[model samples]
Target chain A: MVVIARSALGKLRGKYDSLSTTEKRIAQLALNSPSTVSEMTIRELASAAGASTASISRFVKRLGYANYREFTMELAHVVVVDAQEGAKLFKELGEGDSLGVIANKVFHSSMASLEATNDALSENDIARAVLKLINAGTVNFFGLGGSSIAALDGYHKFVRTSLNVAYHPDYDIQLMQAAKLTADDCAVVISHSGKNYETIQIVKELKANHVPIIGITSYSGSPLARAATVTLLSLTDEIKYRSEGMYSLISQIAILDSLFMMTVLRSSSRTQPVLMHVRDVIERTREEP
Target chain B: MVVIARSALGKLRGKYDSLSTTEKRIAQLALNSPSTVSEMTIRELASAAGASTASISRFVKRLGYANYREFTMELAHVVVVDAQEGAKLFKELGEGDSLGVIANKVFHSSMASLEATNDALSENDIARAVLKLINAGTVNFFGLGGSSIAALDGYHKFVRTSLNVAYHPDYDIQLMQAAKLTADDCAVVISHSGKNYETIQIVKELKANHVPIIGITSYSGSPLARAATVTLLSLTDEIKYRSEGMYSLISQIAILDSLFMMTVLRSSSRTQPVLMHVRDVIERTREEP
Candidate 1:
């Protein structure tokens, strides 16, 4: 898992902006005419963008690629993944397409997010957190916005597993609850961006009071991550559709749900029997008058 | 696409309870010797439950099956599709299973929902309502709770086109907004279940005012479906781990989004250029100083 330095991201963003008129023209043309530019050599790119080959070469270096060849490879990667500048805001989703096509696309995107998540998770950190959870007297969860759904889900899955778990959606009460926590208690906090001000304050208060904090955020360099004993990441490809990416948010919640279910079952022997009993009850009860 | 009558489900539940003594015997044997039970025949099932073959036969009928053979066939279906239920929860989720296995299960469930939705949708009703939308001078969307997110998504997509659209998340504001509508306007109401009182009230008020109504709900026979000029069924599977089945909900929203987008694009030729220009401006601004 390559930990992309914040500085490197900043450098790329900056250099991407600072391309002069000729270089900017070439870059824009590459972004706009991806198929044509992807097939172009340096001279062709210069001709297409109405720029000099030397300027295109300089633009390649500015993006931190070794040479035009590496730069073109990166361009191809971005083009394949994210470069849809002129695609209509929405298209009539085909009724003609088979269910399998729709499902394949949906699951492909979900698996991509899951892969990014695995890349971001640290085994050592997760092990340490699991050890703490195993030793803790109780686990308290805090979340807000769409994230509160994940917290509620965690609470639901963990409650039946013989774990002393507590969660509520109200933010003020959550903060008050966190304030009452002792060192023996564990707090799991989930926020997508990790920069929501109220969430940060609650986390800060927890840190001041010395509670074990488990953070889950997509961005590893977030303040929430710095305050945590362990963290998990939920990744999303930039969702192209509308107001906010509500679809991707749920997938993130599913990941958290998966974690809670896994941890609860692993730490206790009670869940298995309970589940077996439920299944048997459901199955057996299906045979009556 | 078949509507399972509520009374039918209730009767099924009653019949399930009648199998109590036999279920207990069967559960006991199955728990004690799962492999033996798995290998059992009709004679074995009858004996294991400590009931006669006729009783086992009646039991299958009670559980909504035609016969014991059909019951076993359904059980086999559950085994293949839901093998995870046999082994505790998280252990199945975290196992070294192929992606194809997961994809097959998830896709099969989603397809079932899609088919149900299509079956419940009335083509004649939808055509009349779509014609209203195409011809309307104004369209106001009123929804609250989870429905508000979908409502807002519709509004966002439609506003970019030539149509006059309005949506409010607050309940009082939605009522007020509904009050402001006239006979020329159309209202789209959405709910997963048709039972939400607030939505029903707003729909009734809109009715009194003679505003055309377009409804989307899962239950085709419910009040919302009956009240609307058109209803599009949004189907979902019943799964233990899924509370709202948020991923499935996204499919419903995407359907609405596709409709809204297509409507906008259909109206004025200006929309495509506007969308394309918006993307270009966003890119150039982000790329520039």
Candidate 2:
């Protein structure tokens, strides 16, 4: 039997075919009522599933848990993650949604997107991006329309580090900046669709110049994703007929934040003094009033 | 006694002094061990507090609960809210923090800040700001340095709505824009310190022009807080010797998000079509590739 750190429900479904008739009953009950089964003891679960306590004990072990307690704990965690990831229908902005309802929905959606993006991100990509950023002569951020906010944010965060970074609000200026970049420089381009004309233009320019491009976009199959040397994806719920990509901004920001933190930590010896100086500047300005 | 919807722990603390000696002992135990008390049955609590079951029943009623069950449910809610508000020490990035640890800490801190900011927000302020924005001729966002990112974000969000909004990256340009505003316009100013020289200059200009200023700042006692017509506060944990107001950006963005959501919903009649059009544009552009 292969033991793995998997969700209880996942394990139950994965191994359902191989289980005994009595154990299959328990697995069915658990899959059907995860929250209820999570809160149940071994005796309660056994009775509910028409199985015995000994079978319940053996069942949890089969799911890679040492005992029932660990199984329940993992189930509880899955329940929370499921709720955050919109396992239930996420309420969209309706005609008569209250202020409190709107606030809750937006916050929940943002959180869900962050968790999804984090799950999709690979540690290897993050490490590679950090290395490229640390070694780059300059970092340029490219985005247009709605994604410009995220591009500007990336520039803001990276400016705090000991790296030369650039972002421009004007599309033509950004294109010019991209054309001037060399192979020694790096670019972080953001587009939720990853297929914007201007965004692809900048990506082509960077590619022609042989500059390393780290693309942040929602679609893994996007043209920008293909053009970039490395791609980081941001995920949002599949809400049809909604406003423009609002939730993905939070996910994109999270990806940038993680990359920034990694870069700072990886180059702490070089960045510590810079960060301390930034802190001092902030402190002095704040204390002035 | 007057009854109200308050946290169980709040009620216990509020009435602790007036309780009888036996009830005071129960109160102390409940206050000190809210999570434990919430999980305990009436008999369990009585024994734990060295009191009788009758006293526990009476104590809950005094706290405005119909019975012990209601009181325990409210206590459980308090525990969850307390956890969200940073009652437990949030893990900070240490010198030797791993990439996974750094990522988790940043994501958790951002979520915590959003929840805290949401809790601190008053619905009335949101409603009023939305109304002001709807009625205003133009909405100008002002922030310098670290807060410029938030200001830009505010601009990005409001620009999606059916309203006129403006923001500039240069401090002098922002000041000039502020000087040109009138009483019919609105200014949404952001400053983590609420004391930056350029930020205060813009605030003064807005104040002199009698424009309605909506200030978002960390400190409630700063000059910007006092100068603004309405102030919305963003709270973060008190961590000394850190970078320049990084976590507060998440809280500030949350505040802006709430305000934006309310604005869209409150004026859905006018903004709904605009949002749909924006969505169409995004869709059209995304399909170009």
Candidate 3:
């Protein structure tokens, strides 16, 4: 695997001539815009290159990479290494900073997280997740500790739509709920670290039941990412003292927010009445002012 | 009261000659940067103008405004009406849009929300909020429906700190918790509309119990904001089709993230051990890879 040691661009150039029609289009896209391509998910790359995700997966394997994740990781490494030769990343948060400075840094980091997470999403992946959510008999949300908040948020947002959704703040109840989901249901499992023991346990249960999963996390190669039917990454520029999980929380919610919007818009007819009813109920709760 | 009909800048200038020394400094700031000053919390204005928040509050009252919130609202109104005469807001999401387009719109809206929310925050407000949290016997989080997600997130983040924190997803439990809080405790209340009956009920309970409230909401005049000891607004450029609550949620989380970052940085000595232990526990959960 000495070929792995070569630059991603160099490897692409070396393998471009021997590629198939669809694979050649993917290679052309990679060569033309390595930086943009580096940030994209496999489904996004397929859409950009007008190729099937399967073909993109096959193309990466043919390039002597283990999987699509590896190919993109190496490509991102190459692009970042090249770009950072001149460009500097963001500043680190320190103890002596004032409140205004802290607010600015947090907001900037969150904006960057949203941008990077958006860059990695594909139309196909979102469509798939929406379809699964809309057609599922029940949508169960799973997360533990810090991530349970995001799971609960996903449940809260989707409930306004026509979907039947469920979430529990308790880990034991979450595991039990995961065990109840079947192939007909969908699960949105959120974990910043992606390797949390309890979250992986729930994932295992869901997988055993053949439930489709939409994993939202920071790592691309974690167990959750590999096992998910469709994975949506929540990325951030990690810096010391600025808990990476905090920014990932913002990115994860943004991803879920996008999915919620897309689902609501795509199925407006089904969601409109539900939304109106919910709004009316909420209005009734308001004081007459 | 007819003075209210005039632009905020006009009001500021009219009252400038009558203000005391500290109040003159506040007026000068409002005149020099009406737009920026419009977005600031009173604490922020105090810090920027080198005056006490009490003086800034009294200054606004002397300017014919009933309160600080009204003063800032009028100023913001003047600034926005002038700026928006030519500049258009963002595009609204539609059913016909592709997933990628939806992702783009959502991310853009979330980013805008963060920026506006950050603009509204004053270092003084954050410092005050942080100080309240640190000194409180227990930090309680209150919200309902959509806002409960933020409340839960606040609990999750603050629990990681050294402070004692509590949150409940049930409205009844939250109300009960609010009632139990006293002047020694602090409540962080989140609501997008700030008019939700259950939230206001909880706010009433907290007020009756004499607990200091940090209100996070979109409307500056909402009951939550009016009653809060320190009001931090979460703003967004609302569009017709896009759910305004969704963007507000993003803004609320970013505000919390900033507060969380500030608390941890300011009290690193106290929180350092807890963070290290949490990190170790999470690391132990990782698979040997």
Candidate 4:
């Protein structure tokens, strides 16, 4: 069996001859103005193409899209891949953007970031990090400000593994914890910019103690990235006027998830009983009035 | 211009005659074993139907799916809506669940929870909650343990609105803050059980002070849910042996997101300038080395 690799636009062009008249018009619009077409709702596209929303839906189906949103995502993927013009598709949260647009943007951005981060990660790094974490005497999670959420999430996920995991919401407590770490410890440090002062301070202390560090940050050149033993980068589209590093949090969470799964799978013999116990406790607590 | 609203099975059955021989086989399999088909990868489906992956892809597209994933999501949606058998689709994370399966389950559950939560929320409640929050001298966020993450998230989001928001990670501080609130203030209380001892204590304080309380929890009959002036239920499927109310967190976040968006949009004239300022600060801070 052979797989045919074609761009979304190429596929549309290849299938254009068999499309219905209304579908042909929609295809022409999509191929000619992909950036504009990618942002349009089905109703908007239908009105633009002088067809009903039903016709628009059929047109996308004819072109191998299940629905309109998937068509737009493929169009955006094509635009990002072929022309390197992702800005038009990943426009920032503008003041006038509608609620539906905001919801779509945030969700799609997260999915895209996760895919990109997954692509950027190497299996070797995951294997190495899992080994280090499983064998460590303790695993300390460090983050401050916005990234603290991810740090806490990492702690929450790892706690089920029955590994000696620690995280403090207080910055000073985190610093003190970092200072006391020995070479037997492993550290997972997260900062979107990779340059938050407090995060760097914690990283410095970890480095001084020779702890193996796994860094999750968006910036490849930042201090935290430079300091870590294994650096996993989270990628996000540069959306202007949006909150700082908001999209990166999704990628960071995905990275932690992958690591957690790897650790649990690799250490199943040791971790499975603990997982069951944790589940039992959770089940009991849930039953409480 | 007439649109035919058909189940996914109906659409497939209606279009079956027009499909190629291989596509017909895939369609028959899909209509007969949707639950099994929904979980199969394209290759698996192809093998099961004695067809190529390309044929399966084309068959789903012919049936109006954007791609295989969307096709499965639609299948899951149909299974959910028709048979009311969501348990098969959202089964508990078993010990042998793969990383991909876990990720897919978690993400899809979050999306499903958001849709369910959206459907459950009353516009009147949202509008009323927004009014009280916007007019309140201070908005206190109360949660404990697992719910604290949602509380912290709510605090993080509200801080950008330049509203007088209060949240303390410490239970005592939170209780003290609750005790000090006046009738003019508002409180957003979150708990999955709705019967957590501390959360109920905080709710009692707010009730005594006549502070308008907006509650987010899974159980509508619990004390916290019964005590609040407006309750927005966060719905999740009952997955036995799963961590207690883990999926509810996503629904809670969605509720908070809706509330945040409504608050920002309704008070835009007063909040726009502050939002812009917040964006500027975030942008500058993001650029720092």
DockQ of each: 0.02, 0.23, 0.27, 0.14
Error of 3 at B161 (Å): 1.2
Candidate 4 whole-model C-alpha lDDT, 0 to 1:
0.75
Give the lDDT of residue B286 in candidate 4. 42
lDDT of 3 by residue, A139-239 (tens): 88998877888888898888888889999888899989998889999999999878888889999999999999999987766789889998887877545
- When sorted by TM-score, best at the front, the candidate numbers are 2, 3, 4, 1
Candidate 2: regions farther than 4 A off? A1-89, A239-241, A287-289, B1-76, B80-90, B237-241, B287-289
Model 1 agreement with the true structure over A123-154: per-residue lDDT tens digits: 44555566666667788888776566556655
- Computed on alpha carbons, the lDDT of every model, listed in order, comes to 0.58, 0.79, 0.81, 0.75
The residue-by-residue lDDT of candidate 1 on B1-289, one tens digit each, is 9966333223334555456787556545544544344346668887867878877677667667675544443343333233334534222233333322332233334434444544444545545665677777798876655465567656655665566789876889899888878779988887766557788888888888888888877778878889887777677655433234333444455446435544543443645566555445433432112
Evaluate candidate 1 and give its CAPRI docking class based on DockQ: incorrect
Candidate 2 vs. true structure, TM-score: 0.71
* B89-156 per-residue lDDT for model 4 (tens digits): 76766557644455445545555555566667776776677788899899989988768877887887
- Judge the docking of candidate 2 as incorrect, acceptable, medium or high: acceptable
Clashing pairs in 2: none
For model 4, residues A204-263, the per-residue Cα lDDT tens digits are 999999999999888766788889998877766444433556557656766776677667
Model 3 per-residue lDDT tens digits across residues B135-195: 8999999988888889888987888888899998899999999888899999999999998
